[model samples]
Target: MVSVALPQIGTRLSASPTGLQWVVDAYVLVYAALLVPGGTLGDRLGRKRTYLAGVLIFGAGALTCALASNLPVLLAGRALQGVGPALLVPGSLTIVRSLFHDERRRAHAIGLWSTASGLAMAVGPALGGVIVAQWGWRTVFWINVPLAAVLATTAWYAVPDVPGTGRQSGERDGDARRTGLLADLDIPGAVLITAGLAASTYATVVGQSAGWGSAVFFVSTSITVLAVGLFVRRERRHREPLVDLNLFLRRDFLAANLAGLAVFFAFVGAIVYFSIYFQHVRHQGPIAAGLSVAAIGAAFAVAAPISGRLTHRFGPLPPLTGGLLLAAAAFLSLTPIGAHSGMVLIIARFVALGAGVGLALTPMTQIAVQAVPDGRAGMASAVHNALRQQGQVFGVAVLGAIVYAHQDYLTGFRIALLTSGLVLLAAAITTLLLPTRRPRPASGRSRHQ
Candidate 1:
């Protein structure tokens, strides 16, 4: 919601480009930073308690945003709102982990979860447009209040509390009563990785704005590299690290995560630029533009569940690789679109993009989580969301830079398509390296712990 609305608000508020990016970037940075902590807190305390608290906080943040009269206030509220999701997201997965314990059922449940989120991502802009057009921008913020209240209230009763069983009666939940906070939570590794990710995201976001050759961008890039290096070093040494460094070495896990990144990155530029294409280039109003994008989301709703069942039959690669091809094809198809292009032609491209991505994304995400152990599911899911969100930030920033620089919408769009296409191709090539077989757990542990 912040991603869609903040830029419009930035224009209305006459905000600086950096400030405008901050309006969205602040939320993302904070959300990614807090995710591991949120999961650790859920593990230590209880998911239900943490979730309800998150709802209340999120509701407050939404209310604050509605009442804001300036950009800083709104950005502050956005940060608070991010805190809620940081908490709620991990908590929701905890519930899913408990409810669907079996492999088959867990896969289906995860598929439903990923598909529903994509559907909402699909619907969000349309909903935002309608409210902003009819009532006011504040209407979008106000709507969250009632929805949050209902969700929080109902969840208090309906959501059951599940306690941790201290790690199978044979393992220690923590080597210490977790020592102090830093030791208990492995704060050093988390901090290093968080800083690394934030620096990388910042570098990516500001590359065009700050000039790719500028010292600021280069310094950020260096910091990102250094932080990642330190994070790897620390994770290798620490008995309990924020993320298990070994996970990235797994063929199935690494391949699926990379594919996930490419798919989101590929569609993201098209998604952002298409909204511009729908409105500015096509001369459609906000409502029409929003609804046009909704076509992809609606198709995602149809494609996800079917993909889940399909993955069970065909394995993850066929659909995963196939979806990227569709996205690439969809982007390349738009090369000739101009001011006078037919509406049906544009819709055809979006439909192909939505359906193909739906077929690909759900299974890839399933593979990402399903490839890890159960204990690490929350962290694994966090990594999955983090990587994709990082890609989205890069997509919007880098592609938008192309459009901004060329001053020709189609040229910029084509460049973005080429870049995304190459990313998809890279992911596809990596997928080919995976052994052609089903994953079998080592010693009967969950694949995605």
Candidate 2:
């Protein structure tokens, strides 16, 4: 909804390109930073309770955004909204982990999750357009109000409560106590990663505006490096770390996350340019431009479940590799697209892109969680989501910078598509190297720990 209405927001707020980018990045920034702690917190508390709390926060944020009188107020509202997804996303996935015992069934459920997400993307633009056209941009935020209410109500009644495994019988007092809220929260680790990623995001945005060699960029980048370094060191030494760094030892886990990050990096980064091209270059209305991109969502919604089933049967490698290749092909197809390109060509490539995303995302989600012990499902889910969202921030910022640098929108669009294609291709090759077999537990941890 925010993506579709960004142009309107920019126009009304008299925003520069950098300000527009912040409208999107601000929400994603906080979401990515808080996800690890959010997931771990949910695991310590209860998934359903955490999830409902997130919904309420999201609803309140939406209300704040709808009522905002200025850009700063809007950004603050977006920041608040970010907190909801941090808690909501992993908690929802943890619920899936709780419900499905068999790996195959879990994969199928995750596929459904991907499909639903795709469907929302499909409908969002058109829905948002109608709301924006009728009631103005503020109404778009109001739409989330009813939706969140329904989600919260249904979830409370329908979703089962999953108890925390923070305390188990026959464990040493120290080990069992480590699972408690205080020990598991990993506050110092969370603070470091949050500051690091925030600095990194700020650096990218500032570098584009103020030049990469500017003092602000240099300072922010330095903070990013230092913060990230301290985060790694702290996680390695901390008991009950926010992210279990040891999980990366699993080939499947590492590859799937890397691949997922690449895929989102391409998708999110490229779409902002697509929106820009349609609105600025082609002079299309927001609704028309959004509808033009709907092909990807429609295709993804249809394909994701099938891909999930395939992953369940043949392992993640085949679908993941094939999907990346398909996405790369789609990106290449976009290279020739210009202000005068025909709708048919654009629609075809969008469908191809959507299919690729649908095919790959489910398996990536499946692998990230499956590689870990059931006890760590929430943390694993959060880590995957956080990386994926971080990839979006980088993708949008970097590609937007490329677009902003070029006077010609076509040149910038071409560069972004080509760059995204290269990334997808690289991910494809990486997918080929991922383990072909279903993951067994790493670290000798049993399912229940």
Candidate 3:
């Protein structure tokens, strides 16, 4: 939806190219940075409570954006919107894990969740376009307000109350006696990570226009290094760290997350440019551009549940690898796309790309969740989602830089597609390296714990 409205946003807000990038990155960076903390909050404070709070906050943010009078206000609202998803996304997955004990049932449930997400992706742009065309871009944000209200109301009755694990039986007396809601959270670690990611993203977005040698870039780079170094050190020493670094030690967990990162980096990065190409170069209106890109989401919605079934039958390896390869082929096919390329050809490529993403995403998510202990489901979901959002952040910054650096849109678009294709190929190879056997389901005791 936001992607479809970028041109209108730029024109209305008198925003520069860099400012446009910030409009996207502001939401993603905050979402990525806060995800671990949000998961921790869910694990300690209660997933349901955290999720509800997120909904309210997200709605407020949407309202703010809908009423924004300038670019800065809009960015502020976007950041606030990020806060809501940080809490809810991991909690949603954790709730699903709690509800579905059987592995097959859980996999199917996750596929349904992915399908819902794909449906949103499918509807958002086309709907946003229609809304923008009729009422203007402000209406895009307005729609979220009522939707959030309905979701909150429905979830209150429909969703289960999953208890927090903050006070397990094995905890020491002193630890158990801590009364503060956030007593167990690693605040310093969260702060450090948030600062690090922000600085890094700032450097990346600003470097294109300011040059690599600029003081702004150098200082931001230094800040990023220092902050991330501190964050790693803090997490290593802290008890109950925000992100359990030990999770990365598992081969499956590491590989799954890496695959997730690569997938989103390619998908999110390329889609934004596609939206731009349709509107700017192809001279299509918002409605046409939105409709043109709808093929990807439509295909994704159909393929996700099927992928879940495939994962159940064949294990994650075959379908995951196949999807990555398919996506790679789709991306590479677009390297020859020109301004005069037929709409039918472009739409076909997008459908292929969408199917590949839909197929890969469910299994990738299942693998990541399955690798961890049931007790750490929220944290695991957060880690996977955070990395995926980070992928989006970097995707926008890096890919946009690549596009902007070239003299013309066509050269840059081709180069970007080629880069994305190669990345997907590498991800496919990584998936193949995982063990062939399916991961065993969590034991009864572990599930109850």
- C-alpha lDDT of all candidate models, in order: 0.74, 0.83, 0.84
Residue 399 error, candidate 3, Å: 1.7
lDDT string for model 2 (1-449, tens) is: 78777778888888787788788778877888788888887777667778988998999889898998889999999999999989989999988988987766777789998898888878888778877887888888988998899999999889877755564555421133543546547788888988887888778767867887899999999999999999999999987787889989888888889998898899977876786788888999888877877788899999899997888778888888888899999998889788789888889889999999899999888889888876788899998998898788778778877777788879887988999999999998877657667644323332343
TM-scores, each model vs. reference: 0.88, 0.92, 0.92
Quick one: best lDDT, which candidate?
A: 3
Candidate 2 shows a clash count of 0
TM-score (C-alpha, index-matched) for candidate 3? 0.92
Two-way TM-score contest, 1 vs 2, winner: 2
Candidate 2 Cα errors over 4 Å, as ranges? 10-18, 167-180, 438-449
Q: Model 2: which residue pairs collide? A: none
Q: Regarding TM-score, does 1 or 3 come out ahead?
A: 3
